[model samples]
Target: MANENTDEGLKRVVGVSGLALSIVNGVIGSGIFVLPAIVGIAMGAFGVFGYIACSIILAAIMLCYAEIGSRVTTSGGSYAYVEAAFGNFFGFVINWLFTFGWGILGSAAVMNILADSLAILFPGFANPLIRGFLFFVLIGFMVLINILGTKQGIGLVKLITVIKLLPLLAIIIFGFSQVKTGNLHWEHAPSLKTFGDTALILFYAFAGFETSLGVSGEFKNPKRTVPLGICVGGIVVLIVYMLLQIVTQGVLGAEMATFKDAPLAAVAEKIVGPVGATILLITAAVSCFGSVSADVMATPRTLFAAANDGLFPKFLSKVHPKFATPYLAVLTYGTLIFIVSISGGFKQLAILASAAILLVYLAVILATIKLRMKKQDAGEKTFRIPGGLVFPFIGIAAIIWLLTSLSKWEILSTIIFIAIVCIIYLIMKKFQNKKPVETTLETIL
Candidate 1:
């Protein structure tokens, strides 16, 4: 057994397949299951166009991350990249927004959504007390499994990923034969507001690829595999999401836009009957579980990184005495998740997270451009984005343009979130700079 004081850390046990699957798992959460109808309702016949546009945007962002990620071999992912390029303050801000919006509240949303999904099996799950109990249990389960070790946590991700994909694929395969092409027709042109809403929803669906980049330090050949896996994974997920949208939209037709809920299940029932819908519903719940588990595995690394950088409490950086995992960070995240899950206000956090991540993506793209300008002569074996500054520039512009589509409340929430983060950063910086004055008691001792 390895001792806590051995200084051993996370291992490079994850292979190409594991990294690729993690991306797929991270990106294809419960969001995709509901997006078919959401986009269909907004875009009408133009809905597929929105999917294509968002996929391009996401691909550009992922490319920036892939290139930047290859240059650094660290645990913090984007936070590490940004700090190395800009400075510590920028890194702390992004880390704080990410940890608060996505890590804590976002994961809580999944737990609540999973609890709601569980309500399908047991009607009593709709009760607040019972639902809160299950929510606590699920978050606890993820933290405990993760605290045991990375290998074990990733193993769970692999298994749940497979479980998450099967029903979606089944829907696509079977729903095709049952497609009523007449249902695919649109009756009207959507307004600009509709287009904006669809675009935002589509963009949010592709947000989780950073989960893999976070753990690139555990990849055997990060420079080569990180970029390759991300691109491959991005393409794979894009195809899956496109096919899912097409299949669900085709199967449900005009009715999709109004579903506001499990539109995919409605399509399943039309094709495969009640059993298929039940399977899809159960899979949706498990997908939420898988997503929350992925966050538990990846998000705490940001806190661990922050603590090491003196932005957070030192306790968050401690590796488990027996497991070598960032147990304290995991525990911290789990606790916040549990608290937020009880409040049931994750939608607001989800909106704020979506807004914050766009700015974060812009920062990463800028970091990539900065690194390239600096390392033009430093020949390193790193993954390079094809087409140079074109994609990075496009990514930056796209994110800024997308930010305009955010709801007013979301923009306000984002501003508040940033303000809070900056305040905390100032306080931490002051504390880190303060030297202990030798008191009389200390001098006497």
Candidate 2:
């Protein structure tokens, strides 16, 4: 156990397959099952084109993160990138928000799905007290999984990912036979006015691609595996998303767009029967669970990294003596998630989570540009993004474009989140700096 701890702390063990699984599990969640309806409402059939465009944009951003991860293989994702490129304070602030802001939001979204799934099984489970109890129970389950060990948590994610993808793949295949050509109406063309709105919705679907980078330090050959895994995993997800969307739209026409919940299940019911709808609901529940599992595994790593760097409370820095995990941070995150899940509805929390993640994406792109200029001799990055400076530049621009498309309320909420993070960063920094400096003269006695 001690040897394993040393090796993990020194960057080893994880390989290409682990990295790929992380990326796949992170991105392939309820978003694919749910976001199609949201996007369809915003852009009609043209939303399919918008999803394609956003995939391309996300691919570009993935390349930028690949470059940064290759240069500095570390845990904490955007926090490490920003710190290496700019300085400690800015990076700490970004890391703080990335951990707390999105962590609670993501947890709430996942718990909401769990609660809704319970409501499906028990018709009268919609009571606020019942829902709240289930949410806390789910959070407790995830926290326990994480506290057990990283490998245990990741193994569960791998299993859930396979289970979740099966129904989606089945839907794509079976729904193809039931496709109606008349359903696809291309009367509306993709335009600037609609593009931004659609892109913002699509961004939510592609939000978790960079999650692997948060634990790059765990990878055996991070420089080689991280880049390839991110690229390949993202491309695979893109293909799956596009095919699923195309088949679903063909099967259900525009009716799927108006569903308040379980849009994919509604489409499945139209094509097959009640059995197909039940299968899709199960798939959605599994996907949501898989996402929460990945979140439980990855988010605590960021907190552990920050605490180790003296950017958070010291207790969070302690590793479990037996399990070698960040037990305290995991518990704390789960607790916060349980509290938030009781108040916010699933859709609202989903939007809030996406909004918080977009800010982190903006920071990552900026970090990439800064690193390229600052470390000119950083050597050949394993997966150098095509088009030297243009890709990262365009990636940053794309994130900025999406940010502007969000509503005024979302923008205000994001700003307030950032302000809160900055305050926490300042307090931690002051505490760190105020610690007495021990000198050789004092130690010699």
Tens-place lDDT digits, model 2, residues 293-317: 7787777777777777777787876
Candidate 1 regions with alpha-carbon error over 4 angstroms: 1-8, 185-193, 257-260, 345-351, 376-379, 436-445
List all candidate RMSDs to the true structure: 3.0, 3.3
Model 2 gets an lDDT of 0.74
Query: What is the Cα-based TM-score of model 2?
Result: 0.89
- Minimal lDDT window, size 10, model 2: 1-10
The reply for model 2, stretches above 4 Å from the true place, is 1-11, 41-45, 257-261, 343-355, 374-381, 437-445
Candidate 1 Cα RMSD after full superposition onto the native fold (Å): 3.0
- Please write out the lDDT profile of model 1 over residues 78-178, one tens digit for every residue: 78788878989999988877777776777787787787787987899999999988887888999999899877888899999999998888888988887
Deviation (Å) of 254 in candidate 1? 3.1
Candidate 1, poorest ten consecutive residues by summed lDDT: 1-10
Instruction: Give the clashing pairs for model 2.
Output: none
